[model samples]
Target: MDYALKESSTKFETILGTALKVPGVRVDREQFLLQTLGSKIKDGNIVNLAIETDPVTAGIPIDKLDKIANSLIKKRTTNTSMLSFAAGMPGGVTMAATIPADTLQFFGTAIKLAQELVYLYGYGEIGNANQLDEDIRRELTLYLGVMLGVEKSAAALRVLSTNISKQVVKRTSRRALSKTTLYPIVKKIGAIVGVKVTKASFAKNVSKAVPIVGGIVSGGTSYLSMKHMGHRLSETLSESIYYTDADYEKDFKEVCNEVVDVEFN
Candidate 1:
């Protein structure tokens, strides 16, 4: 074992083992610390049993133990957050923005997870990209029904991030993921339907919502609501219908007729 590697691991074991020796935290003997921080291999061989950081030897000067002690004391003292020292302005806006976009991406995971499931089931059955969305929404609502009121933050974040990633995948180019095109589609749906529609919802419902309508509203709402919204919008505006088969021509014309002849009576 490399000298540095062995030394660091020993120090880490001492610190952590000491902490876990307290009641309520059982340390796994097999996994120990290496599982969290993968095995370190050097020169084509496993060099150390574990690796870690130790404050004692990290920046100590061997010649002057007294100076080294003072340096360690200063390092620890200066490392406290503003909130601990005396909260005032706190960290700057740039510090907040510096957080990775991938980290914040969890906010939309629910949509992403839905998309992945749709892709797994069969995107071809959903028709175009829009129809695929309905399928995703239909399935997602069913899944979320089980987790509606769960208060676990980590679980919620994972679900939401997966959902968002799935939504972004569709309408994204074959070569690259891009939400730019999908956002406009959402805006259009929001405008015609008089509700805030999102790419995630589109991905969710496109498969299950018939040719155009979907479960953007309540999970229990009849399919008629989605079809009606699509029917009205189709009549109000000139649109293009892209389908896997020319067979949909009849269905398209029927939808148009339904919109034109619509009556409350």
Candidate 2:
């Protein structure tokens, strides 16, 4: 397809919003943990496990989750690459202001992979409500930001994760995800995404990879890209601390201030 992602915060934000609304796109923490844990975890106990503790501390094996996560990444990468390949078929046309099918699919899979990784690492769902509330959206943005290599996003997530673990709740209501606190961070992340993905790099590469005649080049590129991103988030969540309330309070203030101070056009 001729459509190339533009260098604009609006576009990136729109993509983020759209990717999130897709049916069944967001992974349910309890459901995922149960399925992932399989029979090893007693049915009734598994559901509470997500709210009370993370997967590892609950005795869910890290190796098992890692292996499953790899399979998921590979599967999603392959699926997206195939779509990219199809879109580049000899007669495929690129339309202006249009988002590529491959790009959309990539975000969907990325979000899916992200949620799974968090669940496997022992964090609860970002948001499981019927609506995409501001709180939920903020968390999702942070996840995408982390995937894109934004340090501030990771910091905020660490705070959110620690808070969520402490509460025994389905989600974190911490100000870390509040609009006031996250707006600047969100904008900064958008700018970063715009710079990182804007037709300049991601598009140019994909457009070139899938030549007039479709090929596996683009697919290979996607596989590596998705794997890299998945690893970043997985590593981040794994290392997040759930230790002390005082540490969280200190970290929370610093992260919120730093994120707020960051500016993005």
Candidate 3:
């Protein structure tokens, strides 16, 4: 059992790497902001200016950002759910849990949602989302971990978010986060994810007995899961942090007890 747990956890890390390769998972902050606000903002340069600087710093209202984030979450949720349903169909090419194409796409979509929400809430460029370096990995882990309701990960994010606000220069801030501060948290996340994977409950829950039913379960599960995770990250970014509200922590570390209903092996 312990061996299976370790192997599954190791595979979870690889699964994330594969997810990054999914197109559109890596969101460009400027492009996303421009596209999201373009039709509404009207003025090209003003929108450009907003993208260059933090939206909040450029006087974009918090309520406006919230609207954009909600739209993004909805769109991504629908997309992920559809993919999950398709993958969940029994005898589908990627139905096997080992490969779990739907699971990969789900994370990919979730990452994009996370990026958009982070940008909308006024965070700086989080580095190459595609590249997924150590810092980016740690950052993404924290965001996903928060969605999974990990306490230590949230505390790490709180500290990192505060430090990001204090950063006068990009290099200096990146350097600060690249140290021992976040490593332990990342390790904890790895262990947790590993356990989830080994239990076969990490991906979207699909009932294999009834082919169509599996699709329904997969799709429905993805939609609800993504929506909640998106909201969790959104709230974390918006409140209980230095980015948006003066007091962001209004229960910033709080997470849901049940994130999904996947069956255990």
Candidate 4:
């Protein structure tokens, strides 16, 4: 790997590790969703599930996923915000360390939302951290970059989608992805997303330091920011080529070389 790509990968791992360590970050809802989706993938029941749940989601429309993402974020933000405020209030001093904790909550929520939306859009199960294949992992990273509004990642995703549509296999795709030509873009994406997360965390810390109404302000800020990130992910991922059943099945069979029986009901 290039130096920049290696550095960005390290930063990504560190940030993800920190986020996973936060209490209440891995909520039951997220676990349930993942497990359910994983089971669906294993059983090859995704298409039926999509049709039974929402016919429109067969294409994974951005607006529909956006609504779901908004609901998910709204449901969790209040509790996370309060917890963040309490964590920061140490001897009447808002410790900077608490910022990471608060940000981790948001990161966890954002990641969960991203995964759920991507799965619903027909990207298949993003398995557990240890179980994720390199292709799927890279796809998730690309989605994260999209969630962070990285234009280069977005453009790359489009190209990737085109390639998948052409039935690119895993080896060929991996080779292209591993090329130095793409390393710079991937590195840039990681840097941009990392900076955005850091900046957001800092702003939350500043808002939480207010005297009387700090908690309220922090809560509001967290709510809006989390919702914004969730919507961003939903918008980008839902509209992706991978959202359609046909496209997803094609990619899954060709790229992953797995026979996924898609049941349309």
Candidate 5:
């Protein structure tokens, strides 16, 4: 069992590393969006913005997020030159590898969407890749899990929400979230997704045996999968209680208990 856990952990780390390395998708724009939205949240400008504009003052409207996510996914998948850039490489690299590359790009898109959605829903910056703060990383990980439709992530979010409502400092919130107890849940979520992505890649690769047909198949798969994941995340983040109020302690405690009761293995 210990060996299995270690193997799963290693596989998840490798996949995550590849996903993080996918280039072309921009992070600066998302970070800037977070900064702008953060300011709006601080100044209570959301109400005024909503009053002036449509009903979407706090965060980007779900419909708009959907459209943007679709557009980004399309751009990433439809660019044949970009998709095939690493396909023709010598020795050991083949069309099968492109699926993971595309999957990584999709994850990059998902991360950007997560950041934007989190900010829109009123959470502050959890730091970026360059930051070494474990607390911030842990917090971000919880959000990522939520975006990926992990049930435990929802419980963790509720707990974090409760903490924030009580005026918990970012550091303290991070500390609570970074508890050794929660590590397995986080790892489990990552491992599950890694396995899913790997399996999906293999299935997609079978369809992609022919290079020309493979590009189309891979692009379509990336497009549909990304759209599905992005929309799921947008819906979950958009309905956050943080958007309305911070009095979520009771709710958070309930969720924390439920999360604690969940046996990971």
Candidate 6:
């Protein structure tokens, strides 16, 4: 992939953002686990993120970053409400068991990662699912084609699609168990869009698959919007810890965006 650096960075952030989604104060313990003792999660892989982005274009401007960060804080507070209705949990035990201390750490990391991504790719309306999809696809295409190259574009799109799709599943599944109901619809819509955008080699498959996918995408988008809102919250909180924007200023140790532009073995 020509955009090997960019792809590597994207994956890095996705993994890392999960860690960074927490508040700074909470990150200390997990940071120690990740960086010092080197904690490993489900697999042998250390549950830490390594991310890199261009300083000039990768970090959103301070004002916009502040707006984004603040929004995320609000969303986190709101997401807490979901816990009230969480049938899955018995009580304090569920929150304690399901919501790990490390989640806060990941939340903080997720925020910083969002900052870099929003900096590189502008934020879009959370209300409009189609718009979000288009925005993501457009950005991925440009970033891959212009900055990275063809192979990278495909890879980036796949990654972006997969990531967004995961969010869609996460968000929507919370409300309704069967997002599969949307598959046929998304697949049809996907065909319409695919016919125009897809190249010959992959066009037929895309045409067949997209509407079913697109429909599910449409239905699941509400949750995706919430996830984006959560992401925005994470970013906002992380930035507040760093930059002293009057709108979102906070007292904490600032972490600079570190660049890690190497291929993972």
Each prediction's TM-score against the native? 0.18, 0.74, 0.78, 0.60, 0.63, 0.20
Checking candidate 3 for backbone clashes, the offending pairs are 9-194, 239-248, 240-248, 240-249, 241-248
- Candidate 5 residue pairs in clash (backbone atoms < 3 Å): none
Candidate 5 C-alpha lDDT tens digits along 84-112: 33332222142225345555555656666
lDDT of 6: 0.30
| Model 2 stretches astray by more than 4 angstroms | 1-7, 39-54, 90-97, 130-132, 160-163, 166-179, 200-214, 241-257, 263-265
Regions of model 3 farther than 4 Å from truth: 1-8, 95-97, 128-132, 161-178, 197-206, 240-265
Q: Count of backbone clashes for each model?
A: 35, 4, 5, 0, 0, 43
Model 5 TM-score, all chains together = 0.63
The parts of candidate 1 lying over 4 Å away from their true place are 1-107, 124-187, 190-194, 197-247, 254-265
lDDT score at residue 129, model 5, on the 0-100 scale: 54
What's the CA error at residue 233 for candidate 6, in Å?
A: 11
Per-residue lDDT of candidate 2, residues 71-162 (tens digit): 66676667766766665444444332466655666777788888877777666567655435666666676777888786667766666532
Top model number, TM-score: 3
Q: Candidates ranked by TM-score, best first?
A: 3, 2, 5, 4, 6, 1
**lDDT tens per residue, model 1, 1-265:** 3344344334322322232233422323223223322322222112122222211122222233233323322322232211111211122122123221111121122222222222221121222345454333322332222122212211212222223222122332222213342222222222222111233223334433342222222222222222232222221111111221232334334333333332211
> Whose TM-score is higher: candidate 5's or candidate 6's?
5
Better of 4 and 6 by lDDT: 4
> TM-score for model 3?
0.78
Each prediction's Cα lDDT score? Answer: 0.26, 0.63, 0.65, 0.52, 0.51, 0.30
Instruction: Give the better candidate number (1 or 5) by lDDT.
Output: 5
